[model samples]
Target chain A: MGRALSLAVIFFLVLLPLGVGGSTLFQLPVFSQELVQELLWQSWLQSAFVSFTFTVGLILAVCYLSLWLGQRITAGLSSSRIAPLLAVPHAALAVGLMVLLSPSGWLVRLVHSLFELFPSPPAHWWIADKSLVTMAVVLVIKEVPFLLLMIAAQRDQLPIQRWQTQAQSMGYSVRRCWWLVVVPALLPRLKFPLFAIAIYTLSVVDIALMVGPNTPPLIAPRVHEASLRFSDLASLEAWLGQWLMIVLGAMLFVVVAINQTVYRRFGLDAIGRPNGHSAQRICSGFGSQLLLWLCGLAVLALIVQSVAGTWFYPALWPQQWSLGRWINEWPYAWPLLQNSLWLAVVSAAIGVAGALLVLERQRSQRKKALAWLPLLLLLIPQLPIVLGWQRALGQDAGWLWLLWSHAAFTFPYAYLVLHGAYISFPSRWLYQAQSLGHSPFNAWLHVLLPQLRGSVALAFAVGVAVSIAQYLPTLWLAGVSYPTVTTETVSLAAGGDWRMASVYALLQALIPVVLLVWASRQGNQQRWKSKHVRN
Target chain B: MLEIKHLTISKQQHVFLSVESLQVAGGSVLTLMGPSGSGKSTLLKWLLGEPLPDFQIAGELWLNGKQRDQLPIHARKIGLLHQQGDLFPHLRVLDNLLFALPRKDPRRHQAALEALEAMQLSDKANAWPHQLSGGEQARVALMRALLAQPEALLLDEPFSSLDTALRGTVREWVFAQLKQRDISVMLVTHDKEDAPGTIISMKELTHA
Candidate 1:
């Protein structure tokens, strides 16, 4: 299973882009060329700054918030709940939020229906009112859980208790220890994921297209518009490339500046006795609970909207509920769902297998030449590399190319999650297995794998979540010709019809939500089962 | 003065440490010695900090004439050296020592260099901790704690990871260095011979 998955991943990574090239590359290159070449250095530079500032600001805010939230969550709740919450798709979340915010949305529709007593919808635009608020909110909701999960994972490895105690003994307060010691250590490890989130937020097309300012939408959506519209493909590609370069440069500058500020403020020692907060009530337990409750509410809202038959606003619940949308969409949804499932499953399976191989190889090798390889996918922004790979491959058709594209995205997360679990496995168990004369594979299967079921399940679940959330790869490599739920949802959302769009958006989120729910239970069950087995 | 009174610690419902009383004044040293699993380390952890909550601890601890029982670890103005030289892996030896200095200390780099010179390790200032010999890393860890100018120091088998010959030398150097600073020292060890001051044997720990 491992070998086959590994081979599949390698093959896909190498061949898929090449496979997709025939149609998009040779047959329609001229049509797409103008879209690809439109580079306005001034506008590109301006948006780059916008994206850089927004991204940096967002990451720092999230990092600070993570410091606070991580402490509260660990002190209060179990990490088991985190996975299910994190498993929700970014696109579906943006769509749901757009629903709540758009004037014609559930929010405004209700206002018009209840307050004005209007029999018909209002002509005025309400929520996404030419502001970045909707986009920013969507990004925060989508990104925080990921940052939190990464921190939780990192915390599992750190000697948090011991260090906290030592810091306290040294006259550092709990808040200080967290700020000075924990945050610094945790932040650096988290930088990659945080960067990924920042880049994704800046470059997100689907979400931005759904709710971001339209007339002159964000750079990503504009690029998409340019390509699909065919009036200016070359200009779009140059604009994208130049915007990428500028954004990357600006991001680097801001990241450095913030890093310096953090270093100067916190100093060399990450652990310090923190000064107590005079105003600690920014978000209380009640507020966080509310935030979590709202996140739950968001999921419920989407799930409910996915099933709702037409109902006007002001009602607390949808007046009608049916699976007619699911029924009508099944034939279309089936092939797409199958494509999505196979994509997620294949990508996840391959990613896990690839990660394991690299880890095992690293374990056996005396020299650590490419220890940073797995981190590349995790840390580097996907926009440039994926685009470059697409250009390099020249395009082809086949599952091979599609699978490869997904692997490029999935493998890093798989490596990070699985590598953590692999390293955390007690050496004594392996020693015992060796002493028992068990071969490495048998030892892994019988001793290590069984013990690592929780971590493995968690890693696999995370891998699935990441693959499911992929918008770029599914669109880019699949040529937007194949209508995966993500592609369909994004396209439908582009057309500006909330009711029908919500249906596709919710459908896109369904499998991953189910997978996440299952993964969470499976993780807990595996953890429980392992304990029983050991006992 | 450093005082720990009627301190008790339990892990998974099993009592690890139940010390009745222990005290060390300015320029004094207290050695806590017991067999492995007899709560010697647990007592050191209680005095310094226990990062995990797997254990329940009941205690009153005073440091430098202040009631520090409720003070968090960093605010307690205490420093610790563990069995492994837990130097920040990413930092050079000088920076590792420099990291322990107070934020407002203008001469942190100079102080760290001086500390390295005192340890006869000035040449290794730019070297990573892993690049240093085990004995050298031990000296750096010792200097890092001392340079912080901690009011008190706890040594949880700081020299335990060394070879026998190196262990004796590292222990002698460590205790001497702490003594030179007039810092109160609390040492926890399985080996009684390493104790330099009054020993607290928890073999007869009472039910507090």
Candidate 2:
């Protein structure tokens, strides 16, 4: 049964892009090469900054910074600390970022009141100013938590203690060893996650919508809008844009590949660097703290807006406060909560189970590509996938379709967590069990399963969080029929109703936070319960 | 009696461990000493019936006059104790022993308790693997292996991780326990002090 599921996952991972891409081609009319090539060139020129260069810079910077942070902190400590931020969806986070960074946003208003300082123009000026710096900052904020999570996963796979001791004994500082020894070892595992960040930062539509230079939005948002309009030329061009985004993602993958290839070919795979402490010790400490504090402020801003009766700019706090938004929204919110709950739970179970099957197969086989198949699935952005599914299913898709789409995405994310957990599991466990009188099946059931229950729970929780965070996929496939917290948050944010957006974003963020807490608790627990019983 | 006739193991077109003939009568241990990478662990893997796909093995394994060359590790009824004392961290001290007993065995709990009691560690029935001291873990692991009712046992550097002061005592206890049950034993260790009856040099029995 496990093998069959594993083979199906392998086939699915290998064939999904080709199948979907071909189906989309049949659904949409093909354009002449000259016209398609010209539009692609034009779009590339327009989007090259926000989509490619800035995204690349942001991903590299975030990864390096995260690597540095991972060294300064332990994996257990950092994972828990950043897990709350992990549940904040990209679109919702952008909304929160916009509330903090816009010209009339909280930062400026605080400055105006405190230092009697104000910009020459209105504070809302840079909200749509088309500055890469402005967007990259927000992207960095969102990407850091994810990068930290990936780093935590990779940290467990390394022999860091031996590396630390070896390097330190040779008169190198611990931080120096971290960069020279640890970073090189980590780069290979980090390649896929970095690509994920690159693709996401470059091609997120909903978040781009919240923080758009609407005059000429990023390629993803532009393509999304044009595709929705449904003209043949626009459809053709939108598909082209989606294809181009895939090509861009491929380029990032290629760069990482080429670097590793060159390094390994030259015997640089285990290369070490000269030892030195950077001048940024104080800066890194300050930056990490500031990042956390601001994220706290972002959540706080969401909280304030959820119950804010009315509000205007330059007032750091709300004009009035009430639970009216929550009360009024409760009627529709109840069903959404129910829908989100069931969808997340069902999808999580299927996804995590499928992921375990795939991970188990990967464990016995020595195929590097198969191991990375899940990462590739993750790095491929949801926009192209949703568009393909839109073409395949048309207007009559239902709950089953909804579950498939969400599970398809959720499985890979769950696989990432479960793979790390399973890999770190001591192999002696199963071997030792089998060497006992227990049969092979009994060994897995009686021993290994109990040991891995926490990881399974964590993977399930991650799947649930991934499912709840679905916006474009659910919206495209299920329409408003299955209104999840994420879809409702995006919808409310689109209407410029900050109050209600906050109500749902907070709720959206809350569900995953609760699930994550549950997951962590489940995963961290020892197999044996406490010996002491209540008297 | 346990017997091995012409057992050979290889990986990637290269032979690593080979034994022409070896035997251990009931209540005796044959200590096989070999350097690292000399397939000390691989020999145990073969006896336990889990030789890797990379390795090729051709042999006949006999336990108490039954020719059992091709059986799954669990069905072979051969107990193995590793250097790490690989107890189930999730199972308590007593339950670890209970896990080894067959489900249909009428005296499962009684047997588990007796095994714990025989080790003089009944006070640790609820103790976890991590909570036990190294010597306690080793003793518990030894008792757990014995309670499984194996006709033969394989010990792979089982005493290597113990403190030098405690190592000899644990080794003696393990040998005494095996003899009491008349369980044939193949103890692999580099320490010559661990040699009980016969010492088989794995280096002298190799073709690939």
Candidate 3:
């Protein structure tokens, strides 16, 4: 039974999408040479440049921050702050960033209020509302927490603390030890996550739609717009663009793989060797704290925008603050909230269950040959595979397909979250329980599950966040009949209705944040109870 | 009594250890001393009815003159103690004892409390496994195992993790508790001092 469930999950979630996508590649209509060249030079190159910049910037930022944070803060405190940022939806985060970085946004207003530098909103601001820099900045900010979490998960398996101690004993500074010893070890483990981040940055559509440049928008948004037009030429163009994305994704994976290997081989020996001089310690205590504060300020900006009245340029605070927008928008927002909530809850539950089934089946097997197979969903860019699902299900598919799409994406994350803990758990505990007279099933129920409750809860919370952040699947699969908060937020934000968009974006960000808080609290309570049982 | 007959433990059809017959009468221990990788722990796992997928074994286990090799681990009515005590960390000291008692016993809570009292741990009924000192954890583990009322028990270097002073104390206390229950025991250890009676070296047990 476990084998069959595992096979079914692999088939439906991993194989089916890839198969559909492969078929879609073959069915693309031929276009003119000039058009291909135009897209190649115009859309694809621009998107690639932005994606390349974003991926490189994100890698540097996350590595530096992970090292800096690892040196200063305890893992528990850092994770407590960083993990909640993962719950914020990508589109909502982009909207919040827009509220902060736009010409007439908060930063400019603060500057004007203090130094009177900007009499009015700067006409030509450095970080424009729709520019490549803004898009890359937003992507970097959002992805740093995720990669940091991935590194944290791998830290236990590596002897990072012992290595740090050994290196520091040899007269290396803490920062030098991390760079010379820790980062080299970590880069190899971070390969797949970096690939996923690269694919995501290259193929993200909603964030690009919100903040990316307009004249020849990013490739993902271009494909999205073309696909939505519902014309034969547009459909062909979308498929062609998707084909291009697949090629780019494969190329990017190779580049990242080669980068990891090269770094591990020569970079470690040459640059990572300890020099005679002790590296000067830079005061870098505030990296993760700064990120947490930025996330907080983003949420705060959203809150203020949602309730503001006459919030003009160069004004630090709104002239008036009222709950009128909430009152007016609540009627339209109600169903969207319900849709987003139910979808996130049901999909996250299914995703977690699917992950458990696969892990259980893997445990029973002697050889875990394809242990990383499920995570292929993450390595593949969402655009092509989701486009494949759209093609297979047709434009008029039902709500179940939408839910399935959400679970398909959420399952990999849930699996990634649960895999390490599930695999490392001592099977001897179950044996001990059985030796004490409980049946195998009873032993598992009483022993293994309780021990893994924290991991399970966190996986479920991550699944919920993944489901809440899904914009493409919800929009492409369900359309207007089942509009979700994410879909509504992106559309409203793109349509220049910041006030109404903030209302939906806040709702979008709130569900996952609340679930994450509740899950972490549940985990903390279990730990506290086990450690502090009374006499 | 706990007995093994015609026991052959081999890997890939190469017989490494063969025992014609061995027995431990009730209220006594048969100690097998060997270095690491000498199949001492593997023999104990087989006695405990753990599935050893990497080995080929042919043996008949008899507990009190009944052939018990076909029984599952739970039904074999055998207990095991490892070096680290392996107490259930999620359960408090009292609940760990209670988990070993029969579920249908109406006074199971009182039985558990009495067991703790016998170990001079009545005041620590609610303490977590991590809160206990090493000697206390070893004592609780022994008490928990004996409370399960197993037909026999296997000790896999159970006292090896303690300090030299605590080791002798815990070992003596464990043997006293088992002898008081009149339970059969097979102890595998590398330390000759850990064996109290009838020591069998691995070289004597292995086939040429």
Best lDDT goes to which candidate?
Answer: 3
Each prediction's TM-score versus the true structure? 0.63, 0.90, 0.91
Tens-digit lDDT track for model 2 on A412-454? Answer: 7788777666766665667777878677678877876677776
Q: Locate the minimum summed-lDDT window of 10 residues in model 2 chain A.
A: A526-535
* Candidate 3 residue pairs that clash: none
Cα lDDT of model 3 by residue, B155-194, tens digit = 9889988999888888888998888888999999889899
The DockQ-based CAPRI class assigned to model 2 is acceptable
For this target, which candidate reaches the highest DockQ against the unseen true structure? 3
Query: How good is the docking of model 3, by CAPRI class?
Result: medium
Runs with alpha carbons beyond 4 Å of true place in candidate 3: A1-75, A169-174, A269-284, A366-370, A525-535, B12-16, B102-104
CA RMSD per model (angstroms): 19.4, 4.2, 3.3
Of candidates 3 and 1, the better by TM-score: 3
Q: Please rank every candidate by lDDT, starting with the best.
A: 3, 2, 1
For DockQ, candidate 1 versus 3, the one ahead is 3
How does each model score on lDDT?
0.66, 0.74, 0.80
Candidate 1 wrong stretches, greater than 4 Å: A1-39, A75-78, A104-131, A167-173, A229-236, A239-243, A246-250, A253-284, A319-322, A363-371, A394-396, A526-535, B1-208
Clashes of each: 54, 6, 0
